[model samples]
Target: MRVLKRLVFWMFGFATLILVTPVEALEKHPLNYVDPFIGTDGTGHVFPGAVVPFGMVAPGPDMEDRGWSYSSGYQYQGRSILGFSNTHISGAGIGELGDVLLQPSSGTKWTRKTVNFRSSFDKVTEKASPGYYAVTLKDHGVRVELTAGQRVAIQRYRFDRSGKVQVLLDLQHGILFGDGPRVLKSEVKTDAVRGEISGTVWSKNWVEREASFIVRFSRPISNVITLPARPGDRAPRLILEFDLRQSRALEARIALSTVDVAGARANLAAFGQPRFDVVVQSARSQWSTLLQRIEIEGSDREKRIFYSALYRTLIHPSDIADVDGRVRGPTGQVIKAETGHYYSTLSLWDTFRGVHPLFTLIVPERVDGMIQTMLEHHRAQGYLPLWTAWGRETWTMIGNPALPVIADAVAKGFQGFDKAEALAAMIATSTDPRPNAPAWAQRDWRAYEEFGYLPYDLNEGEAVSKTLEYGIGDDAVARVARHLGKHEIGKRFEVRAAGYRHLFDPSTQTMRARNKAGGWRTPFDPLVPTSPMNNPGDYTEANAWQYTATPALHDVDGFRALVGGSSGLSRWLDRFFSLPSLGDNKHLGQEALIGQYAHGNEPSHHIAWLYAYSDTPERGYEMIERIARTFYSDRPDGIIGNDDCGQMSAWYVFANLGFYPVEAASGRFTLGRPLVSKAKLHLANGTVLLVERLDMKDVELNGRVISEPTIDYKSIMVGGRLSFPHFTAQVPKAN
Candidate 1:
């Protein structure tokens, strides 16, 4: 009897303990789960820097190596630290924008070579969170802490021993990729009375543009030494000396603008006398607010990967407008952004597939601003941006990629931008000839209009890829036209959208290149890949097998009929994935292979989810699970390929939520298996959406069973619970 009473007492005490524990104590702040270094190594090409979400200035360490791997100016494998730069490009294949290099050194004299000032740091002392990064310089015994506001980079240098300190400013410093220095013209001026130094650098790299910068110091400058430019140097360097005997620390604020030095000064003044720790806290708070929008139930590792990807998706299409709303337009003229801001760094080809759709759900406010920016670019340049960075068109990628993003916004009922003007811009970009066209843009639109497709003989290269991409763009234009009640224009583009059928060869069951004489090109191989840079083949960064299965999101029934029935389409997909990948000669864009399905590239991103169009969505679930398990992790080399300004990460984010936007402009998302057991989407519409995976086959939205294989965007935005069955009924929720 006594032992039984003790057992009851123990059970009672345990239940009481559980009841008293606060629920908030069990959860961690979203910022704690983000690891900024996940994509810093391997082919990820992402920078582990200190910058707010969509901020203009990203300050990070530039490594000794300036190769393709260091496109973001920092590589995990590199050991030595070149000076930190105020601007950087995140996850770009081509390196550019390493401007305004600053190095805090113990040496007082200016060396002719900048390499002498480089320091070696141990990896153990390196630390990074969302908005803060810190490292210890081994040679000088100084600790470097970096933080940022929207347009300013706050840097704090703490010395172990106080004496003399010299900060070197290289006006000509910029990222290079085997091409020589990019600085065309640069000039600098120092004001000892104001404790400020300002400069302008006009560089021609990925895109030719001018950047102005101003640097403000916390302490008065003791002296300034100017280093003469060598015979081959483009600009002079300056060394500012500071006596740190009184204090062992120094702080500097660096602000940048595409307008002019006055704009840079205005940007600097916007953040008045910012304390380093206070700025760091504010940045963290901003990240936390965005990250908390989606709450999920998963393991620690899962949370780390999810939040890290979420962190990267918010890094680009950065806000480049100054505090006074002044911005440099595409023509290099100062223009005032009527929307109070302007955004740049548009990687449209990769982003239109997933990134913009994701933005409409959680961050709808930024969508209007981005659309306005594109419209502004269209006004300055003749067409929408193919690939842009720093308010300049690079003409890097092919096709009209921006149309789908705008059309998707219109279809989703976003009212922030002028829809009729957006439709006109899309039509003009599609039909009008661009000025000073690049080689890829020099195609004969007359022939395309006559033949309903771009012929391999008439077009320079990427004949099949361009035809299919143009068809997709036309479909987007048609969708917007129809929504705006322009029935005639919608009908015209609908006919043009079906032009992809002309290139589909029924014999090989693939998209084959055709000549102007209406004959198929010879020497065709479905398995062999092609690239625009190396071999100007029929496809762009892909092969026939991948392009043939391109998700016809605009017309599912027509694509199914062309491929055979649903069973035939499923068989084609099975064969596509079951076949072996091409050998080492495959294009660099093709990586992270699952059979022939390349998750590393954008063209194949929607293919895995294409299984939903067939009878077997279970197969797509299997592929998505395999991809998430194999390609992503919490390490430095986690990402399998370039983040491509967040498209790759956006794919993972949507896939994890159990659905994907197969057609970005179609307002429909096909279902897939959910990775997390439960997720809460805190949408911008002031409603909470709860998604859960249960032991059932039918999907339920707000407790009502969904009969179709897809869900529309409106239903998701309305804010309700969406429940899906587990891939296997026996499988339990992730702990």
Candidate 2:
């Protein structure tokens, strides 16, 4: 009987050990949970490639097809490989930057056209991770592996049954959508003795830019043949042949720079003679370190989705500065970065809402550098970037969104940047107009200063949307101005920020377009989505319903008053989601709709969180839960829309943690439902914040019960524990 008791006790002890072990310890490495292909299909538009976090060299396979779907150059549905390019913009609506293409062929004839050298690959053989991508070309039996450093792309090719292997270096290749950028000029130099190929290509795409690259090969080159440019192609191509009679494997390190080929050479020399495996390991380590910041306890699928979303969040605002801190300024002049690091790929209109706020929490080190880069942009271009890539302004989206980012940094108390200079840049960007700016970029400062709001008749289009957006920017400037003790500037911009109230129509209970004379525009349809590019309605990529709640970010109390108090606001929200969606329109940025709430675009991202101000705060949590469950998954088509340089993914990361930056520059995060059972936030200030869902409505910060539905950035930074003690066991059903 004693022996039986001992056996039972031992079994119970072993069970306890298994149950008590941390989920993170029992599972695979954080890097293993990241699925790079999650957003590669449908409208996700993210690339499945080898890239270090915010690396300049996103080396990936470029597809044969050239259009909207191939924005990242690689789509999950694509079957053919048109070589690999060293640079690509991930999750961009407009495609560009597929520079320095290298394709390996095992044919007897030398081909001039890219189609002749293109090879089809099977999906089963293709594999990708955080920093590594590999695929086998079936036609030529050549295996391609790609990896990257911050500025260099490392490629390895293994030829099966090899005799003579050739690599085509196509200088004219780039991702072409509607009227995409083409090669304006190009120059190539080959050195057979040194086994190096260096060149520069000047192209006019989303922006006119130049990229310089130097390719250093591990094997000796047998011959160099320059291919003539095809019809309508200006830049030339080169075919480098290697005698693979003795060896079957070849490796090439391609370094890129915006400054010059000399800069590219310097970039290459920075990481001296590192093997492909070493670079891959280094990239994996870097991703693991960043992913380790937020640890959660959840199912394998949940972890995969969560970590994959986290992976996408760190991919952009790429390090554009070379190793020596030399970068091409916004006005196309070579300049040295003051901070030794300069970043581009600023999708401010989209990212300032969620991505930048997330950065302040987990990656505070990068925030200053990004702000510095924006300040430099204002100095060079006379305005902050609307949307920029590779150190040049694209002027793609609407609004003065950079203000929010700078203001958020200041409000968070990050002292790495110059506060006065940042305030000046924000004021200039908001109030000043550039002479050489595009018509769309010139936001009619004269009319705005005179009338307080951008009138429909005066502005080109998107007048209502621009007015709302400008009001948000003005609010951001006012916050910074007040913080800096500039009382007059603060009060002036504060009044300007309230300009959104003028367009609010109480009769229709929706924001209406008005002319400069304060007369409402005729034939107002609230449900119709609008854009400045195509459907020239008053909205920007959204309908009237989405913008209804946008102003709430700045002044929740004022917005509540405008919409007839808290209960009325709640009822309006209920109607907003209950109404049937117009339909899916990718071009209009309307998809993944919960009624009129377009989760696919940036405008609707924060509307659900506004439930905090309503009578039914649980309603907001319910909607958040539904959105997370319905729109996100672990599949290739997991994301509802373009990641938009990680904004979409950042939203998921914030929502999963049970809060979101409703007003990105406000320094306060509104509480919602916590998706994860528990989350551990390793803050940049060396404090760890533990967030857990308990069985009550009141939230506790480090054992202190908080009555409010919001928490400030200072509280999170000086972290301990944030407990959400209120939630249903199952997802609350929508009323």
Specify the highest-TM-score model's number.
2
lDDT of 2 by residue, 197-253 (tens): 998889888888999999988877889887775676778788898877867898889
Write model 1 residue lDDT over 622-659, tens digit each, in one string. 88878887888899988878899999899889878999
Candidate 2: stretches off by over 4 Å: 1-27, 112-115, 729-735
Instruction: List clashing residue pairs in candidate 2.
Output: 181-204, 181-205, 696-725, 696-726
Q: What would the TM-score be for candidate 2 when compared with the true structure?
A: 0.95
C-alpha root-mean-square deviation, candidate 2: 6.5
Score candidate 1 by TM-score against the native: 0.94
Question: Each model's number of backbone clashes?
Answer: 0, 4
